[model samples]
Target: MDYATYIAGLPRVLAGAGVIFRDAEDRILLVEPNYRRDGKWILPGGTVESDEGETPRQAARREAAEEIGLDVALGPLLAVDWVPGTGRPPLVSYLYDGGVLDEAQLAAIRLQEAELTAWRLVAQDEAGSYLAADMQRRIRAALGALAAGRGAAELEDGYGPADLRAR
Candidate 1:
């Protein structure tokens, strides 16, 4: 087969990285994208630039810094959600713990005007009101794993408990 044919036949998947940042009040930080017509509030993150050979964790950290101007150390992987896409290849999303930011860090937040318009810390219960249903599920599962002292979770379409038993 020609190189072009081989490349065309290769399976492709898109990857994105996001950080789950919480305040001392345990509220999740969410951002509103200025470009989205739907006006969905989303976690501070963006697509991993594959050409840069960026790992998911690195992408998460970079995105957090670029989006919120907070340069805090990222914690463990909270969750990995595999989402089915529409008119595109599936996506694997990585969520990292941004480690609870202090008041100083919160006060320093500066949204990227080109991509984000505003950001706010929302209570866990009210997160659903701002985020899409799938995002709400992913956040809730990550929070549960955090509270239970469990390691990272693998999810299918943001659905939980990841059925990791041997197939």
Candidate 2:
């Protein structure tokens, strides 16, 4: 096929990037989105604007600023999850470390009311109750990756790099 035809025939996939911000106590930051009625909380992030020539890292920074009103320099990438379709195209998500937030920074938060209803810092163990299964996995993997002092962890459907019952 010709270049244009080949490009047009390529499978479509969605991409997102997020920043994992933590409190001084090391609690993970989670946001309640106004869009989801299911009540699942998520990290600060959104769809990558590829059409606007935005990269994953740039998207993460932009989303963080938009959602939580903080402009921060991100740390190393923590995790990447590949999620299959539930009712739409597949998705690939990138997670980066936003580092710790000080008291002043925490107090300065201004939620993007159009998208977020509230935000909280939840303990690592408490993340499960607020997040989706896939999200829990991604967060665990990201934290594990950070703790292990390694590079990013790869996940499939937010499950595992596990060919087995894995971490």
Candidate 3:
């Protein structure tokens, strides 16, 4: 096959990035996306513009800024998940640590009216009630990685097994 044909024949998947922010009280910040009718919440992030040469970190920063008016130095990555879509292609999701948001940072939040309707800090345990099952698992993996002080947790379908979480 020609080089172009070979490249086109390769497997493809979508890429996205998100930031996991925390409150001083250790509550995780979740955002309500307007696109979902089920009232499910998610972390602040969007698709990675890889075609435009955007890295996951840059995508996280950009999404944070666009979704919540946030502009702070992000901490290390907490999780990297391979999420299989229901009908669409699979997604390679990067979850970065946004660290703890101080009062000043919290006060500066300006939700993107078109995309988000609200944002709130929810306790880790309470997060499952507001987030989708996969998201809840992703959050758990992310937090576990953060607490472990290890590098990013690797997940498959949002479940990061014990062995894969610390790498």
Candidate with the greatest lDDT versus the true structure: 2
Candidate 1: C-alpha lDDT: 0.88
- Those runs of model 2 whose alpha carbons end farther than 4 Å from true positions after fitting are 163-167
| Ranking 2 against 3 by lDDT, winner | 2
Per-candidate clashes come to 0, 0, 0
Question: How good is model 3 by TM-score?
Answer: 0.94
Q: List, residue by residue over 40-81, the lDDT tens digit for candidate 3.
A: 999999999999999999999999999999977889999999
At residue 140, candidate 3 shows an lDDT of: 93
Candidate 1 per-residue C-alpha lDDT over 35-133 given as tens digits, one digit per residue, 9 for 90 to 100: 878767999988998879998988888898999898777888989999999999999998988878888999999999989999999999998889888
lDDT of 2 by residue, 52-155 (tens): 99999999999999999999999999999888897899999999999999999999999999999999999999899999988998999999999999999998
Order the candidates by TM-score, highest first. Answer: 2, 3, 1
Candidate 3: residue 33 lDDT (0-100): 94
Q: What lDDT does each candidate get?
A: 0.88, 0.93, 0.92
